[model samples]
Target: MVVLAVIIGLIFWVTSDDSGKNTANSTDLSGTPSYALPSAYSDPSASASGVPGVSGGSSGGGGGNAAAPGESPAPGEPGIPGGTPAGETPQPVPASGLCPDQNISVVLYTDKPAYVEGEQPIFTIAVTNAGLSECTRDVGKAMQSVTVLNLAGDRRIWASGDCAPVEGVNNQLLKPGQQVKDTIDWSGTTSTPGCETVRQPVAPGAYQAVARIGEKASAPITFNVNRPAAQ
Candidate 1:
C-alpha cells in the first residue's frame, strides 16, 4: 500500500511539470501583438498613388531644370553675335553755314583777261554779317577787319582800318544781313611781274607771278614777264 501511493504521487508530479513547460513554449512562439506594432511600417509601392515630385512622376515640363510634364518651353532671344549686317553704309555729315551760326557772307571779284607786268591790279572783297546774332557786334569798328592769306606761300596779311566794320564803313557792330566791300590794289614790279617769264631774280628759270583773291581761297591768276635780251 505505501509503494503504490508513492508511485502515484511521482506520476502526477511529472505530468504537471510537462504541461507547464508546453504552455510557456507556446506563449513564446506566438510572436509580437498587432496592437503594439507601428501602423506606418509599409513598402513604398504598397500605397495607392505616389506624391507628384517625391515618387519620380513627370515633373514640371519646362525646357530647362525640373519643369512640370504639361508645361511649354520658353522662347529664345535674338542676338547679333558675329558683326554688323551686310551692305550697310554710313552717311556723311553735310556742311552747315559759312561760319556756323554767324550770318556772315564773304565774296571776291576781280577783272579777267589780266595784263602782264602791268599797274597794280584791283579787286573787291565783300564781307557781310546778316545781323547782330550772326556777327559779334561787340567787335568795335577797330576790331572790324579783314585778313588776307597766301595759301600757296602760307603767308598772312591784315588791314583792320582799311576795310568796313560790322556797323558802317567805320562802325564795329555788323547788323543782320548788312554788307560791306573792300577794294584791294595789288601792284606788280619789274622784280615781280604777273607770270610772263621765268629765270631772273635769284633763280634763273621760267617763273610766273600769281595773284589770288579772298586770301587765296579763290583761284590764283597768273601772267608772264619776259627776260631782257642778252647784252
Candidate 2:
C-alpha cells in the first residue's frame, strides 16, 4: 500500500510540474500588453535605432510553432513548434498562423499629397504579405493607428485613436503578394487622449504622416497643409 501511494504522489507531481511549465511558457497576446510601444509610435529619444523624423518599432505576427502532441522539438523550427507527425500534412492554424515580421510590409498614403487647412484628409494604411505562403495576421482596429507630426517629427499633432477608438479583433489570412488596407479621415485638427482637450484646427505648414498596425509601420510620408489661399 505504501508503494502504491508513493507512485500516485509521483504522478500528481509530474502533472503539476507540466502544467506549471506550460503556464510559464505561454504568452498572453490578447490582453493588455506590457511590451514596449512599436517603434513607429515610440519617442525618437528612447531608442538608438529610431527613425530620423519619427520614433519607431513594430507589430508583426508570426506563425505559431506548437509541436505536435507528444512530439519533441527539433532544431531550425520557426514560430511555435507545430510538431507534426512524419509524412502527415500540417494545416494552418487560425489566428495563430501569423506571418513573420520579415514577410509583412506596412505602407502609408494620403488621398492627396497636400491639403488646405480646415479640409479633411483621407489616409490609408496598407499591409502586404511579401512571403510566398499564406499566413494570417490580426488587422483589426485594435491593432492600427495613424499619426501626424511636424516636419521635425518630435511632437505628435494628431492620432486616430486619441479621442474614441473602436476596438475589435480581426484576424485575416493573406496569400503571397496579397495586400489589405484600412482608412481613416483626419479632421484637420489637433487632439488629446480621452477627448479631454478642445481640438483646434492645425495651421498651414509641412507635416509628416505614418500608419501602422500593431508593430508594423510604414515609412513616413510628407504632405503639405497649405493656407486656404494656396488652394
Name the TM-score of candidate 2.
Answer: 0.57
C-alpha TM-score for every candidate: 0.28, 0.57
lDDT at 172 for candidate 2? 85
Candidate 2, residues 26-90, lDDT tens digits: the string is 74443546776564565545654554655355435845575889998556746764775233232
Give one digit per residue, the lDDT tens place, for model 1 in 117-230. 443445565555643343332223333333333334344332223232234324334556666665655443222222334322221222222222223232233333344456
The lDDT of model 2 is 0.82
Worst lDDT run of 10 residues, candidate 2, spans: 85-94
RMSD of 1: 19.5
How many clashing residue pairs appear in each of the predictions shown?
27, 18
The lDDT leader among the candidates is 2
